[model samples]
Target: MKFTVSAAYYLLALLVCGVQADKEPLKDQSRLINLQSSRHHDVRLHCAHYPDWRIADEGDVLHFHSPHYPRLYPHSSRCGWQFKGKNEGIYFTINCQVFEMEAASGGKCKDYLSIKDESQQSQMFCGSQSPSLTVGNKVTMKFQSSYRKQAIGFTCTATAYLS
Candidate 1:
């Protein structure tokens, strides 16, 4: 059968997607979807919100400091936080938990009430996208959802593929 340029384009597209039928859509996001590290090295989960996320590791102690977030825009993930008088603190380094964030009710994040009822696993929602790690050596995750336009912005729900 004869195929025109347009047909070839669509065919090529289908072939590509067929091969990667089980991958995340927006891997282009600044956040590291799948992460890998050496046994004795630290990978920095850059702060899109915090220009700086460094903490003083004095005697290997984790610091509990605040990170000042900008104002929250309505219907924006960033809006869930930074209220006028609803108890505020800046960014914090969540060392003991794995926190992953997708597009929710707010920008980067809209509002959070802490996962306190259950295991109380400490987590940090660092705006837009959140990068999580296993804390020992290496961590890897995969994106499963296709990229789609939403009220907040473009987002993809990546499947957490562990090493």
Candidate 2:
């Protein structure tokens, strides 16, 4: 009878310790998942700063414009979009649908749409004109406004294709 009681006590202790050992790894895994989820949220918040910015991949067509385009854009604001090709030899072509900004002071535009290519050269445009440009693999479009008078901003579309 004494041996039976001692055996029952030993079995009960082993069961409790086994359950605890299983729970520890599960707790660590839950904490790791929570940490990864928070990091992903932070990355999304960082991208939110460019409200009007867009990304275009190869064989995709994307339209971008200043904030509140067609109506006057806000003063002292900057916005842009980036286009990337899917393949190394792919390129992008862009067309302006409606382009209007504050006129240039001298030869340089005050409020302007700037197109930059992979070569790092930039072409600036202003006023009510439509322009077309082709760039290699990657292109970035930036629009800037001063603190003074504003104008209806630009509307443009970009298409990517293999070279």
Candidate 3:
């Protein structure tokens, strides 16, 4: 009877230790994630992971950064997009990159610009499909069509390079 009690105590101790170990790793990882991307006034989208994801690494997230404004277009210098409502559509520009992040190490991150236009879905041209203005590490997009007007949603895959 005494031996059985001793064995049970040992097992309980082992289980407790295993649970503690598991909790600490998660806490530490979250801490690291928070520390790394604290630059944008605590703005970040942690839904993305490397190598595996639900949607293709193309354009699904909206990262708002005002610094990418003042584009010298044909007529006047204007921001790429002007989203009306919060849930009406998603808008963002991949101008500010995470240089210290491991996922953005190479220029191969496939965050593409997806243009969901049922009217022109059959079209496979560059500008007609999605406006993926890939300039080195930045991708800018302008959805000329609207949901009620033209039904074209844009998306882009953000990438990075070593140099």
lDDT of each: 0.28, 0.67, 0.27
Misplaced by over 4 Å in model 3 are 1-127, 131-133, 137-141, 146-148
Top of the candidates by lDDT: 2
Poorest 10 consecutive residues of model 1 by lDDT?
Answer: 78-87
TM-score: which candidate is best?
2
Among all windows of ten consecutive residues in candidate 2, which has the lowest summed lDDT? 38-47
- Each prediction's RMSD over C-alphas, in Å, is 18.3, 14.7, 18.3
In candidate 2, what are the lDDT values of residues 11-103, reduced to their tens digit?
Answer: 654574332222222335445432111111101111113544334445667667777877898888886766667667878788877888888
Write candidate 1's Cα lDDT for 11-101 as tens digits: 7656744322223333565753442222221222321332332322212222111112222222322211110111122122223232332
Candidate 2 deviant stretches above 4 angstroms: 1-55
- For all candidates, the clash counts are 16, 0, 12
- Per-residue alpha-carbon lDDT of model 3 for 31-131, expressed as tens digits? 44321221222122222112121121223344432112122112211223212112213232333331111121144321222222212342122222233
**Candidate 1 — what's its lDDT?**
0.28
Runs off by more than 4 Å, candidate 1: 1-118, 133-154, 158-163
Ordered by lDDT, highest first, the candidates read 2, 1, 3
| lDDT at 22, model 3 | 21
